[model samples]
Target: MNNTSVEKNLANKTVFPILFAISFSHLLNDTIQSLIPAIYPVIKHTFSLSFSQIGLITLVFQLSSSLLQPFVGLYTDKKPQPYSLALGMSFTLTGLVLLSLSANYHMMLLSVALVGLGSSIFHPEASRIAHSASGGKRGLAQSIFQLGGNAGSSLGPLLAAWIIVPYGQFSVIWFSTIALLAIIILTFVGNWYKGMVGVIKKNSHSITAISPFSKRKVVFSVSILLVLIFSKYFYMASLTSYFTFYMIDKFHVSVQSSQFYLFVFLFSVAAGTLIGGPVGDRFGRKYVIWFSILGTAPFALLLPHANLFWTTVLIVPIGVILASAFSAILVYAQELIPGKVGLVAGLFFGFAFGMGGIGSAIMGKLADETSISHVFFLCSFLPLIGLLTGLLPNIEGDRKKIKSNK
Candidate 1:
């Protein structure tokens, strides 16, 4: 009879259509975001930038993107904003235009900060939408959502190699079209979300997950997760922000060839993203978190020492293995604080970005003071931080066992 009635009649089952729609929007949004770093080589050369300056660009961008997400998530958790996703896209569109026209370093920084602002608005609300539509399949929904982002990220380097490099900086203007398309799709999604908001608000209190840990235990576990995120993203920064440079510096690969290598590693990330969520749903998020972060240790340790061919080969497993951790970690955190989905998403995503930004800056400085090879060698030890995952209390196992006994 009404919005609430309409929502109630449909079983709380997964909404595939909406899931796919949001995921596609994610792909579009991240494609635009990835362009900034994708064209780093071009910008670096065009501006006569040092590694520290390059890293500062990323730091500024990431800080803008990361800083607002938690606040946005917290605010939206209290008061949902359906059309904000579209609004975020508008910011991205503006940024894309400015970036294409950027004539100097300051202009580039300003352009990326605008794009980062858009991302700050996008992730939290989008994550909430995915969680709401999940219908108990949180991990799978998150993975599907994440797969699109990773896929889009992988495309950036490849596209930059083809478009930005050949045609020059002006070519970035073309991706403004991608941001525009995302805005349109997000409008449609916004309409659907508008209708669902009433129902979602009513059902919010019932969305509690059963956690077996005490409050102190939950907080401790979350701290462990954050530490794990720092380790993961710190390591990831070396590859994502510097791997292309590393390739050119060490192997004497052409700039275009280096981008192709970056693309391969990123594509592996997209492929591995499918593993964590569904597997976590079946097995346990903790186990997935453990293997995903720690399993990469062997591969990562070998990566910096390998020859060019082997370096490329080793990056695949490193990317794939490390890529699996986030979905598991995010879902696990959501489960930790049952009702604060938005806050958890915001906190985790924001922290990841912050770590990445910080890591890039530090690595850049290290590379400048020493060498890119030294940076890679030092980062190789980061995955070993996964050992702290053992400190995570097995909340999933406890919840299952308690239910079975009852």
Candidate 2:
């Protein structure tokens, strides 16, 4: 219960049981989150919505999700709220129920907003929990945590295609069961977190973080990382928000088939998430970030010109390559700003969601004004921003130098 005891407790080997529990909870959380976007087509028809309207829905949901995260992370870094996880999921459950029962546009917005609110709460604490339980295996822990989310995300479209698309709007209520299950899992995780509350007062300040770079260099590096995030998530917005429509419009694919294709892309993403962290742990995170983002450029450039079959093939590499970047980027940022795990997680996750929202809105309008093909073409250039990876100071290398000096 004392500070030294707490440090010893926390510094022990990675707690795999706690890690997997949180990862499974993340899967349940994101599975519910993904439902909103997945059901867009059905709701578009039911409510006679426009592409811009769809973008606005994302905007609202994302704002609610993004805006609160930094503050939530900051607050929890101070207080370490053990039970907030379940509280957050309760909001999602309410949102799910409302979304299922929603008969009008405004109500739908409110429902999605509530769901977004739940996400803003969940990520920082969950991420902190993963970090706390990581011992020394930061990258691997983050990857395992993210794998659940990507896997859950990949399930959304497929589940929507099977469940909601056929059963109609009311069937979204069925996913309330998913939300409830998450709440149960989160409650269990919360109990574990409660036991760690002995570290609260010293948690945010006790650890001495040594940065190899100057404050200016660190700030500049963070800006570059943000830019990279913009590139990755903006391009991601094109695919996650509109890929199905793009498929139907260009290839004349059925809605179900488009959903199936989206599943393939997201499943590849899940696979990549599993790879990024461990590889970053083995190699330098800078290399992982460089390869993951920049590596996607070739396939992205080829995507607009490919036929339906080729497009499907291209999305696999796109998803896999692009998906690897986030885990590395996040872990790299945490290394940069050590001990502020919640803030780092919240900032990056919030910014990623913000970029995705803004990107979706801008691209939706672009698709309305130009064509989805044009939108895809323009977005293809985004991965090129990964070139900024050259500028980041090598944290791992710097740490090795520090140790040798010691």
For each candidate in turn, give its C-alpha RMSD to the true structure in angstroms.
Answer: 1.6, 1.7
**Deviation from truth (RMSD, Å), model 1:** 1.6
lDDT of 1 by residue, 1-406 (tens): 9866666654277888888999999999888888888899998989899999989999989899999999999999989899999999999899999999999999999999999999999999999999888888899999999998899989999999999999999999999889989999999999988888878877876555556678899999999999999999999889999999999999999989999999999999999998999999999999999999999999999988899889989989988989999999999998888878888888998999889999999989989999999999999999999999999988777887988998
As a whole number from 0 to 100, the lDDT of residue 392 in candidate 2 is: 88
TM-score of candidate 1 versus the correct structure, residues matched by position: 0.97
Name the TM-score of candidate 2: 0.97
lDDT of 2 by residue, 168-286 (tens): 99999999989888889889889988977675445545667666778888899899999999999999889998999999899999888888988899889988897889999999899
Tell me how far the alpha carbon of residue 197 in candidate 1 is from the true structure, in angstroms, after superposition.
Answer: 1.0
Candidate 2 residue pairs in clash (backbone atoms < 3 Å): none
Q: Which ten-residue region of model 2 has the weakest summed lDDT?
A: 198-207
Clash number for each model:
0, 0
lDDT value, residue 264 of candidate 2 = 93
> What CA RMSD would candidate 2 show?
1.7
